[model samples]
Target: MKRQPKGTRIRLLLAAFAAATPVAYGFFWSEVRGRGTPDGSSIEVRVPEGATSLEVAGVLAAEGFIFRPRVFDAYVRLKGQGRQLKAGRYEIPRGASYSYLLKVLQTGSVVTTPLTIPEGLRVPQVAERLAAYVGDSTATVLAWLTDPKRIGELGVPGPTIEGYLFPETYRFAEGVGIPVIVRAMVGRYKAFWGTEERARAAALGLDEREIVTLASIVEKEVRWGEERPVVAGVYWNRLERDMLLQADPTVQYALGEPRARLLYRGIDSVADHPYNTYTQPGLPPGPIASPGAASLHAALHPADHDYIFFVARNDGSHEFSRTLREHNNARNRIRLARESAER
Candidate 1:
């Protein structure tokens, strides 16, 4: 048999190669872009920790989300994202393309629950909100909060992590731990107290914790912004004169529940409680609630006044008084107005 000429053989080889290239390319595209399940349902895939890109591809393939794991692996490596796939449970569409799967895994787009903690929530209330965030029992969460070692690590002084968790809308990833959430909240609270706020607290002869404690009282006392500083002033004045703070909120705090109308019997019941301001003759042992930014600012910059008493106007406002007689008169006037209106 005679061998073919070199030129003729080369031409035949090129023709054959050219014919197969398009077919191979077509097959590659079809497989990479193809959907996974027949119904286009969403598929749940868990990528184990420290798993390589190829390993992730294999995992997805086992979950019936990918037809060709090598192609997925090649796609990941070609994009220079071999080590970028994060470890987490992912809810990917069954028909997700190579590009979509890579994007989701690389970005670590885990599902999150947005938790909005309102101001004035005590520690227990904060635990309740956290329970919803992480599906932990409230008791478990409270334990985490009150853990002495954890509280020490968090730089909080109290027996529990109270009055330090900042109120905000936080987007917590699913399966996130309680310690992470607590750190996040306390970190926000720390960030809020800048140099100027700290300096003001020093000028007032109060430490950072003391300011927060007073701010918490102001937060529970009045909801209106204008009244916050005024109410703080009355308390500050009382402190200066060594008079009882006599904050109704303190009585409510001692009772462990809010009362629509606090009676004398209720006050007497908790008279021995350390949180009762009427009997304590000063600020309570600590903050009664988590104060918001407004209350914190007001506590730092209380209105310079000699007002020693305040009567709630029942309209989110207060009538400040300079003396006991003035405060008593104001209270009587409010009572008379209420009585007359009742008739």
Candidate 2:
């Protein structure tokens, strides 16, 4: 080939450079804008409070959600969203583009698992439900519940936070620590337990813990709204008369396992157990389960009545009586009705 003039060669090189520059820029832009990974499944990413953009990028990269932390950091800065990154657990969809992820982080679109802690669930039951959503195991949650330091920190008055873990619907981030979850639950209890309730408890010659203990019993005993205060009144009547509570649920609690139906023999056998009200002179040492707001209120404000006994009517309701003879007659009637139905 014939050698070209120096100026012409220089001009040709410049043209080539200009052509290649656009291609390079396009490739870079596409790389930055494209999905970070090939996997199309969802992923969870946790950004701790006060985490810098670089740290967040590193976490994403480590979790296989992103291919390049350095590129992610640069892109975040370029978008002026570095300071907007929020701390939470996010469910990043599979094949999500970098821009989409950035927006999710900036907008605090975290993945929250809804947890419904129903009224009257024991600590173990609560822990099992919690373990299904959070990172902790059931055993870990149980330990946290009984941990003296944790309970003390939360200012719960009992040996464990059994009755104080307010039962309600809560939204928790995936992989949330046990302490944070416990604190949130206890906080909810404190919020619902207002000053007026405390004053009412004091006026009734009971402390907060005693009130919760009685409320837990009421929650387990009755399911109907109108029956709570009536049942609470019956228990109060027994207490005032220095009579044994003789509650069947207390026997079940003492056995550490709930029975579908407690026979007379079973109740007799467990009567001596500390939690059994049939033999115990007073209330159980602590609450058997978490009480709902209505049950708590009922314990604080029991209805004034002369009734001292009740029995389930097998239809989500109860029959009450003011005397032992009437209670026995009602029990006989229920037994006859049950026998007739079975026949």
Candidate 3:
């Protein structure tokens, strides 16, 4: 082929450069445009505890909050972000670029407010904790719980949002919406109920809602993890025989009080309440607390025994019995143990 003239070659080079410029700019600008402008819009990003960099990238991509999560991975690789990524809430620019978002998450830049919902706490108590932490009124939290719109938004498969909110430590950003937190907690509950648990519940002829209700009862009965299955078995036996659960937790739930001790009057009051297992047969209307995985598992696969009663032992364990006579003896044993310890 004949060599081109110098000027023509130079012109050709310029044309090639011009052609490539738009493609390069388009790629770069697409990333930029997808990202939220840092001018005024801020977003809260959560880097889950013990999450991998790829998991974080997936979350960011799914949220549409970051542009190019691959860029997040690359940034983490270069900046050692993977090692430094902290589990907490982070405030970031809405539509932040993946690199910037990763950096923010890596540095724990999300403002964190601690919310602790203790085990066995009722919905009201959990609402109060969230209210105190979020600086929102407890009424606002309560309203959110009862708001059918909000509950629907969370996709909680029930009429009310009660018993769906998982109890655990949650770190929320300053501007994180309450609905978002509630949905996240509910999602946690669903996730915690793995396929195995679902299958077990199905085998037991129980649905998710019923399992949760039973789990809540088991949770109340089980002060110690070891005793959970035992208590669960007792409840299951009672349920099979058409006996009242006669659970004090249900009575306490009906009374809306912390059940350190049970009152005979309360159980015998006969005032109609859905949660009073003494008055009502079968599971309560809903869960009383967010049952952990253990409780849920126990609810589905109760211990193989004919136990119909259990009494709390002094060391947070329980004594199980098959019959009322056996249960009475166990109860007396526990009472004697308590008295001896008191002395």
Higher-lDDT candidate among 2 and 3?
2
Using lDDT as the measure, which candidate wins? Answer: 2
Worst 10 residues of 2 by lDDT: 28-37
Better of 2 and 3 by TM-score: 2
Residue-by-residue lDDT tens digits, candidate 3, 1-343: 9998756764575467558897754564466445555577666667788888877877777767756777556546545457677777666666676556666776677686767766666678778978877789999888778777865677765546766788778777766777778777888887877888777778899888888888888887787787788788888888889998998888887887775778788777645887888888888878887777788778887888877877778887777777889989888888998899899
The number of the candidate with the highest TM-score is 1
TM-score of each: 0.81, 0.75, 0.67
lDDT string, candidate 1, 1-343, tens digits: 9997756764565467558797766666677785555565677788888999889989988987778789888767767689999988888877787888889999998766688989999989999989977887999998888777876799875645678888988887767898898889899898888999989999999888778889999999886778889888888888888989888988998999999989999999998999898888777778888888989999999889988888887576788888889999999998888788789
**Candidate 1 off by > 4 Å:** 1-20, 26-67, 79-83, 89-100, 339-343
- In candidate 1, which residue pairs get closer than 3 Å at backbone N, Cα or C atoms, i.e. clash? none
Candidate 3: worst-modelled 10 consecutive residues by lDDT? 28-37
Evaluate residue 50 in candidate 3 and report its C-alpha lDDT on the 0 to 100 scale: 89
- Against the reference, the lDDT scores of all candidates come to 0.84, 0.85, 0.75
lDDT of model 1, residue 311: 88
lDDT of 2 by residue, 1-343 (tens): 9998756764575467558897855555565665555565788788999998989999888887667788788778766678899999888877677888898999998988788999999989999987776756889778867777866799986867889999999887666777788789899888877889888988989888888989999999997889999999999999999999988877888888999999888878876788888888888888989999999999999999999999998686999999999999999999899889889
Q: What's the distance in Å from true for residue 170, model 2?
A: 0.6
